[model samples]
Target chain A: MTGRTIRIGAGAGYSGDRIEPAVELAEQGKLDYLVFECLAERTIALAQARRRADPEQGFDLLLDERMRAVLPACRANGVRIVTNMGAANPASAARAIVRIARELGMAGLKVAAVIGDDVLDQIREQPRSLSEHDGTTADLGDSVVSANAYLGMAPIVEALAGGADVVVTGRVGDPALFLGPLAYEFGWSADDWDILGRGTVIGHLLECAGQLTGGYFADPGVKDVPDLARLGFPLAEVSPDGSALLTKVPGSGGRLSVACCKEQLLYEILDPGAYLQADVVADFRTVRFEMAGPDRVRVTGGSGRARPDMLKVSIGYQDGFIGEGQISYAGLGAVARGRLALDIVRDRLAITGIDAEDLQYELIGLDAVDRTGRTGIEPREVRARAVGRSRSAYAAGRIGAEVEALYTNGPSGGGGAVASVRQVLAVTSVLLPRDRVAPAVLYEVA
Target chain B: MLLRDLAHVRTGDKGDISQISVILYDIENYALLADRLSVEVIRRHLCALPIFSGERYELPELGALNFVLRGALSGGVTRSLALDAHGKTLGAQLLDIEIISIS
Candidate 1:
């Protein structure tokens, strides 16, 4: 409430797919803040693989080369950016961003790396218990592929408050990046739950970048939405009374209408009455949307309740190890032949004295009938996969090694040869309440 | 459907869908828009496609019409056509309606 109205923009395009276009918009000098969301569950494994290949590599390496073109203009224009492109390696991503800043001759720009979310090490040290929503306890003895804490806006607010112009973070609550700017600019305290909830709603609205800017409007007749190939992301100009205006860079692709803004507002919310996030539960029912202009929408009438005492936690663990091999079959009964091959493999594993609990099998291309009527289809070809799990990683690895012996010893009446078995880690998930896990035990690595 | 008669249409978000609330000039005109336009009339004629999924609704208070769509997020499945990511685009497409206001 003490600061001037600050406008912040966020977009959902990836650097590999839409980097150049985003850079062009940055050169236009239209935004006060920009946030880029580039991380997903699968992206975490990819980052881990890269770090394993070369420990010196960082998370931003996954962004591809196209983003390099835009760093200079972004720095020159003073449009501070917050990106989760750091993935699991925030220090590496921060170092890369700083290197880019230096190469562009932009000096004295403070870049803050918001770390401590990657909790794999901490989970191992303490080995806490987690229960599911159904009240079942998750088994931690299984192998866990990856685990990271979903950080909230407080760390981000701390980064910005430290006078860092560009903030880079790992897996954080997607909406928190946008809300962090609000908290920093307005001096909103952590205990201001109502305003924090309202800010989170605004962040969710603009989180997808182009959705609020008319990229997905249902209206049939709003014409000429600018350069769609270079669509600009959206910014929310918020007032202390909890009203906001959604707009994008001028001359960018896409249009902004009440319809488009409302569409983004409802995405992924489980309950309209209580739209929950890591920080708060935003009430979408109390919100209102109005058409302010050709490419602008005014969002008002948003009200917030209180926040939950416990923070929702995401816990991941090793489920098992899996090995998959594929072969093509032609002509009649292709699916039948594939099923036969699977039975032979299972028989072979049993013959080797592998316990039933230690093994699992799946056929990707088979048809099965159920109450729903024809649950799956028989494709032209099928990829059969087998998985194994045990208390030890070596036992799982041995199961993967056994799959390759089938290529020469069993099945194979016709068709192509079975590929060599590839060992893969298995992962599972559970959720725990705030009290069971302590955040103080996890320390940020500089 | 007559473009001028679209004045009674209203749009909003309900959960994961972008709902368009439309009321025809009268009960008889309801069939006219339904028969003439089809759902594509609104979708194809609209600028931001793929990112939005649509369904029609009826409101008796003002004789209104509504269409709710599934995906409206830019990076969501509506833009990429991926089944897993389309839910984010639902509400963004709800804000794109335009009517001539013929009352």
Candidate 2:
């Protein structure tokens, strides 16, 4: 049964995705492996910085909560777990999981830790001008927060092969979490490009836990999804050759349709023919998604190419500080008052010689970030917002303070004044020689 | 009418780039979106934003068009000071674009 097909359930999509559905999958989905992909582009960097601050930290914030919620159920059902929730500190996370398993009386549970993605020192050794063409890459100095490479499925497959009840990883490609178990159970060779490619396409679909099951596909009347409050996460039934049936926990809320499957297949892929990852270049050009049954889609015809020689690294650095202030205007001429409020803050920054590196002023309801939602008509109320960026947090705080001062000194009808200042952890991409970095694994049997 | 009238959107992000997929409910609208959602048209429609370059890859079998908008994230999720760091709303913004029906 394990050789021919394996059932895998997506537990959590991101670090903070809903977990109740994952518990449902563990209790009822009959999954062989439950994969939780909780890492994002910036999450690992933030996690690494957190680890630097203190030991026994730097894991996913909800790690303990998620494990406590689902570990007992998963152990009772004999369902193994594979996850990239270790974030910046896989060892610490693995140690904690060992403690949790012992506490839950499942002392035999084996958790594997995959590490060596961190390469900040390596990045600083060979500094070069960033390749991002945007103006934002300028003025990036010596303050780097974290540098971690996007690891592949090699170490994870090793853990699964070594009889690990749970595989913990940090900074792996999203699809790698799913592909590792698929590769291990199916015994597909690492160099098997076609199977790996097909597996990656499935991993991509399942990576964003509830996306394929209709969590993000709902609209009021145009694209309606029913009972979304009880939306179920996705699970895949894969054959040895990488052909799979995508479905969800039966009786769950969301609808699984061709639209959801197709959108997910194309999500985050730059070129369908050349979706580059550390393991293989997944090609989705010839893939197909057909309705196999109700709430089930059959996926097939995926292939891959040779792996890239260079691996992309996401580097996090202390970029700057952001200061923001918002004040709401209500009454007959709220739009005008909101507009005037923004003007006052913009002029106040200049008049006070606050040389903020970048500044933006917006009428909240009319325009937020881009020139979006700008209709000719005016609403009864609008919030005026001003954001300033600077090298110093104090200077950034001053920009927001100036806007707050208008609450008492000026801007009639202004209420709900708020201001905030926060440090920015900026991210950048650089290519590292693939051979220069390696993924190593450690196992802890409770 | 708006693109959202005929299709739904899904978003993904990579550094400074934002990828939005416009998937039509009915496969019949594939030709319409393929014909209308061109580089020049999208560039012109999204001129207000700081888009350095745009690439459109069409999947006829899936009935979808994937747009990779470089420099769309206002720098990036962590780097950008924008409230919506990941440019999660770009797909909604694209859906709001006026589509001249190919009927």
Candidate 3:
């Protein structure tokens, strides 16, 4: 069983990613599994808020639509599904998928929900030490919304071993979604650090889906890519030795070359020699990409050491609120009017006595991105934007109100004035002992 | 000549930190990029917001330089009020750095 190669395709990189590429993968990419890595750093915390509002509704917002779009093709192609789109509630997400599968006339579809990642209760009982910042759970106080431990591949491997046609997970490591299936297929032991490390290299490369296939690589005249508007997602064909050829579906609309692979190899990673994951601490120092064929890149030389003892947990809390307002100016001297508009709002914010933090006033087209103010050529149009973070929602609302008031009270030709406010959900990191997390797998059969 | 003439950049974010990888179009120019694109040069180029700290990693094999900037996202994507919360545009901004060719 371990001798045969297994093919895996990345369905979605993150939540709210496009759906068509995933559908194309299921229909065309001949694969054993299609993994959708959806959850982001603060995604689960916001999902917890949705869960609080309604017990049955904390999963990915596009879960229903994505299932409806991909399930038909997956069932026909014999491609199993794995995803962390379950977000805050994997059980509910599993139930939703089972319902969709049954509706598609595929009855008796086995879906597994990987639970126990939500360790809010564990943190509450023993307040784990913070990792990224200098504080404990006690310092977070009542503002704490959610705390989820980043799970590893064991639970997912267990789910796949139990014959789960679909795996819905909550807060697992992004790479674990792909690594679990690889470990299960190859029978790679958990202690097999080097092989697991190689598998992680593949996981990290394909987790972002289209990023590996030139979707994010196009730079117009500088680095041209063909048919990028309908860019293809990535797939990897892995052998038992942990080596893989990363490629995309035939006739797909994106360039898959060594340049794309090289960029993705270092994406979001700090130290290439020791890229840490729950399953393995992968070393990409000697990793190399060789052009095998069109849209095919052979990846090798990935190794790993032992896994870390502590698991990283993302803790979400209500930080405060953010208020923002924008007004556009057109024709000549638009930059001047936009600057004047920002000045008016800054003065008005002080006069209104609103306590805010991290306040910024920017002219959108001129100096918002290039902060050095070195762009000598003035644009014919510019937008004035004022933003601030405040302790209260009411105070945050005033920042936008001040900008809106500029429509009538301040600069002339300041049109398209818009203002809005939202409560801020900030996330910080904490580390918990591996034994502290109890990962459980539950099955839902359609 | 601008750095964009010889290199391309891609930015990634985790919390409040931004990681940018500057990959050269040609492997031969790695030494020049490694010499000119120091941590201080990037700090000065991005002086608008005080980047709390930065670290540069050299990948000579891949002809790439990876720079990790801390406290750069205005408190990160979850709570940052900036329109571009992910700092996706920072890579493009860094391309403006002028490279004094030593040949």
Candidate 4:
């Protein structure tokens, strides 16, 4: 048995996450790997839109800035990179990384791009039943923009084994991004369900980066987290046995405690026992955490079952346009005036013969956040907002136009009127047979 | 006293479903939370939403209650017209549930 432990750092949780924290981890964390999980549910679909317009530009918009900022430090510290910033185009993203590395004067950087997650043609051919919605892909029809299956950690493990310094992939499972390194470093086999499950727990805890380090844990008096502006991302020191010590950089902002870990454990999860991932059905129900030090927590006791037979696919379709407008009112009777403004817009939208499918009117300061009806408190200020969705952009535009007209038409003390309309590239899910998604990896040397 | 006094909640969303985990600051409060905080109780508390259904899962050792609400986000973040489309503030709102007659 080896007494060695690998230190892994989570750089960014989402695509547009702050880059400074990642740079800090690369330079100062003394880590073996730095992983960035950038894609959200709808991000890849949006990226597909960009790709259709221009093939070379479907990757993350911030990939250039992120690579330039972190590459130098990562090269110096011998820290490898794993990320899903590839979005809709992993090959293009990998090529871009090589170009950035050459420009940074770091030559011979082995970059691997994992492709074949794009299952658009396959999904179109099969027209499988949607996982969440009632209908199948056929119901979506021509409005379907993109479809990518959630790839597993196998291609990533292969990429690392091939001596790739950076592994960029498209739509793989989020936890699998972190699990790849663990599987490679520990030599965990495909059938090692227990170890993989525990590793997945570590991955889930670290995937969101700053969330484990108190990014969202602050309250005025309760759960107060200091220096949120410079919040440090999370890192895990995992042994071959699957136990991990979760902590953050010393002298960094944010708190790393058991409370924060517990919150992240259940984030976006439905069944605690059955967190169905691409590689395994991880059971986090038995997971436990303890305070190891001032900014360290020891995690243990998570297990898993075998992998699923089917792979989940994210399908993005053109779901019409949404238009919204907002106007603020302040001073005495601000709530009343805001309410009146919303009422006028509501009536105006109806009077204008708006062809909106759905409409919502809200008083921002009073009931916007909770959606639990009016709070009934007359605050000093309020913003009236009107939003609607329609099949036609012109019809959606009318919803906002009615609210903007309220400045000259109705409601006293109205100010800061703004309106806009945009296309909604909405996303849904479908299940595909595992064999359908044949993941392939391509390497680029810089 | 309100539930916020004894616990903290974190809200997460996937599609139209919202997941809120209510974690007690102390494990001693686990029994109280588990006994009083039922799916029916939470459904009643959040009656204003267009929620189709809800399910509650309890983690005793962790002193947490995980609630999954279907049809809560009004079509989730990508489609919802809500100012806070992800329903990120739903955790804070759940904290407003008053834990009555705790002696």
Candidate 5:
């Protein structure tokens, strides 16, 4: 083990669900590095829509206020912070961080913004005749909500190497935050795939903070832990040989257990034998986890192969319009009545010559078996629902109007009440190979 | 069927679905329980009526027996509702399973 150990502190709880307790742990631990990850598909769409409405409102700026409250305590204890909370806009996020650092009177603080993962503009720049691989002509009929490329750790590593205390990035791989620190500390090159892969795994393990440290463990009985409202997040003390010990802040709530570690290990990964990321392919099966102490699980004996040549690109497009409405049914045969009401509405729409592209109907609260041919007695009440798509919003609205009419015309209409309809923006996604989205296409906006 | 019998149960809709996670301790024990009770036993004892039209089976990856039910509500009365079949079953089915576990 090297004396200059590479310690990694993972920041979690950004779903606004568990962030407060997670943040408290970071402040109390006096950690070397703090990382917060806050990105999801739907979140990207929402952020993009906000950016379109106002360029400055893209990223999750709410974190700024939260971070501001903690920055003083973190600075006082000399802890550095890194986060992907930048979301769609990194420079803007960095600017906010800079202001906070200055306000805190932290001298010699360097804030770096890692950008260039968004490729929405590039996708548009291509000739209008370009196809989407399946021979379907590319069409931007509706507004483009979001377009972000998933980048690796190079930019973040560069930011850290340039002496930046806080690194803010947009749409970076979750593991990149953890990998960036290792690369900067060990002087690992971009192509040094082996160590980079190990570092990526370390990042993946620690990304969710308390997750590996026992936040969602089935065993070790986490429910019995005291003060879960103030649970501490996990941090890894990684060695040069790619070995790591997982532990949380002292005096924290959760306990580190083998079951919790395994649960997190199995979360999003599709294949344990081939865990693919932009940097490396880590083999989780070869990796071993041992409970070292009270809140410490030692991670070791992991191996890696090579990375896939093509990077997985997430492309979103406009599919069509969708709308939905719900109605409630009560009393005898409630489940059957709900289903009958749905059929009545569909039959009414068909008779009215409504040409919806597709239609779906469901009866909730019905004592109905699943696709496996299981059945049960009808419930006392059931919620009937339907969904469909059309070429225009007007066509979609027609479906909603018809559903409302059913309250008076359908069998269950005597008692059933129709809820207001909701219209959804249509979105679809496709994957393009790495070669299609070349690095030259990416650029930083001043 | 006991909660432990549902070591792996996948519940989702046509294309997109959210995870309704249930962790079980033993796979073999759960499989044996599933074989004895099947979906019929679950519905009779648990009061969870199957909603979808197609045949549902167990998916090992989800670590739970999965049933892909169709025509379930998308939280609305129109076919354009965002609620999928699997999501509609969550409330009644999960409660039924919980009752079975306690019993």
Candidate 6:
């Protein structure tokens, strides 16, 4: 029997977000669905590298851990699972889940995977300039790693309609993950733009999970949120009309208030009158929220225009590798020592011909984050950091090695020197003709 | 008085654009905030920043002002060398803007 009101919990916001809160929400929130919006901009590039190494892999790093933690509670509570944890590979992720269900001895757990977001090969054939930039995918050329289009809600709802217990996907729009359950439960029409717009609003609210529940919203004493240590994940009590009461589980740590909601409502948003997503162009300009009670706020007044004709594709490429090293200098003449360390690294890079595409020599305690070059007093200690993004890992490794050599090379009290290098995968967006992208869904039961 | 005394702030970024929302606690303060937080004023206030341009959008119903700062994050979180690459700290940077009461 379908419940009149569907409550879906936002299990995880980013890929590495806490798993314990998801367990708490699934076991106690009485949710019909738990959605995990895990993929971030550069994460897919890393996933692509995984797929290159092993075809059986290419899902979120925390997928197995998160699924293991949440599956028992969800299955026992009759809650369904939905996530974009599939990363670069939905099929493998689905098979993994099916296998996991068998291992857990929960037979007949239906799992569905939505595919076709990866369009790198197709994009390569027809290279075009990115959104606002002059460069095409061709310019990125052979360095191109992975290409994925942000999909909408239709495929997810299709999977849910087929009686799947869990839905795993790759590169669906963040809001589309949450909107799927609402459309599935409320039986909302696919073309119901206003309802979709309202659903989009809730999806945006719950997309980041803890953010709406005061995770990033807290300011101690000034704008206080209680019990933030054990902050609760968000669950929307969504109704048929595409409106919902935004709240969290009782006794949860974080505060759910209009102040918090307002911030998240506009978070990462540009042109509030027209928030273009895969499904609809949601308008939150007229959005209003009122507290129904403590931690209970009713959100309403969102409308929609037509969806965009093109879908945004996140194109990840091997931008090169970043090498970084840091060394600390303390006591008198620390500022001078830090300056000397930076100068040495600079000179070393110049002498070594490590012509990095981008290089930074920062006196960390002074001008690292703030570019103002303001040091109130010559800090008692300052850390000199040298970083460079270069074409090769070998070149990237040298920037730090050059900095570490400063210890024996002598700049006075150069201690705690460390160096490391890692491949850098950069991301940029390009619009693809939506019709050219064919998203498909398949279901399997273990 | 500090902008924080009158309003709460949130910051978001897209590519190089830093989107900031200044939401007032009281609906009445919208007028004062609207009058005070102008494009020129904000541009000048944040002139010390590495950003290139600023544009503002007002939502009076929600008692909020949305400011989109272009070239703010250098190249954004993925590639920017800034520690706060996403420009998440821009809100606190913005809250530092003082709004003297006309009264």
Q: Model 6: per-residue lDDT, tens digit, B20-55? A: 999999989988999898767666666646667778
Instruction: List model 6 lDDT by residue over A232-343, tens digit each.
Output: 9999998888878988989988989998999999998988999999999999988899999999999988999889999999988877788899999999999899998899
Winning model by lDDT: 4
Question: Candidates' DockQ values?
Answer: 0.05, 0.65, 0.71, 0.79, 0.12, 0.62
DockQ of model 3, rounded to 2 decimals: 0.71
Better of 5 and 6 by DockQ: 6
Query: lDDT per residue, candidate 1, B1-69, as tens digits?
Result: 235434333344322344444434344554545544435656654443442555544333223344555
Predicted model with the maximum TM-score: 4
lDDT tens string, model 2, A316-435? 878789999989998789988888888888888888888688798888777775544347677778888889799888889987797789878767989889999998887787778888
Best by DockQ: 4
Candidate 5, A1-446: lDDT as tens digits: 66577666776634343565546655776567888877754456666667778877677856666677667766776666778777777777777777777777875677777777777765566523322233322455445556666677778777776777778777777888888887787787777666766777788878877666655542223234555666678888877767788888878777776556655655455445567877778766555677788878887765567766755544444445665666787887777777887898788778888777668677765422242345567567777776677766766666667667677777653354454434443333444455555331111211
Better model by DockQ: candidate 2 vs candidate 3: 3
* Poorest lDDT segment (10 consecutive residues) of candidate 1 chain A: A366-375
Can you write out model 3's per-residue Cα lDDT over A225-334, one digit (the tens) per residue? 99988899999999988889999988889999999998999999998888988888998877889999999999987899999998999999998899999999999889
- Rank candidates by DockQ, best first: 4, 3, 2, 6, 5, 1
Task: Looking at model 3, give its docking quality level.
Answer: medium
Off by over 4 Å in 4: A374-376, B101-103
Per-residue CA lDDT of model 1 for A1-446, tens digit only, reads 33367777664544344564467556763666778877654456556667778775648654435336656666677777777887767767777767766766777767777776766665565654553223222245434545666677877887777777778887777888888888887878776777877788788787767666756443455333555766767777787655787777677777787646554665444345566666776666566667787677888765456656545444433333333344445456766766666677677767777543435455544421111113345576665555544444555454545555556654564344443322333222344354443322111212
Interface RMSD, model 1, angstroms: 12.5
Which consecutive 10 residues in model 4 chain A have the weakest lDDT in total?
A: A369-378
Better by TM-score, candidate 5 or 2: 2
Clashing pairs in 6: none
Question: Second chain TM-score per prediction?
Answer: 0.52, 0.89, 0.95, 0.92, 0.44, 0.91
Q: After superposing candidate 2 on the true structure, give the runs of residues whose Cα lies further than 4 Å from its correct spot.
A: A1-3, A133-141, A369-374, B101-103
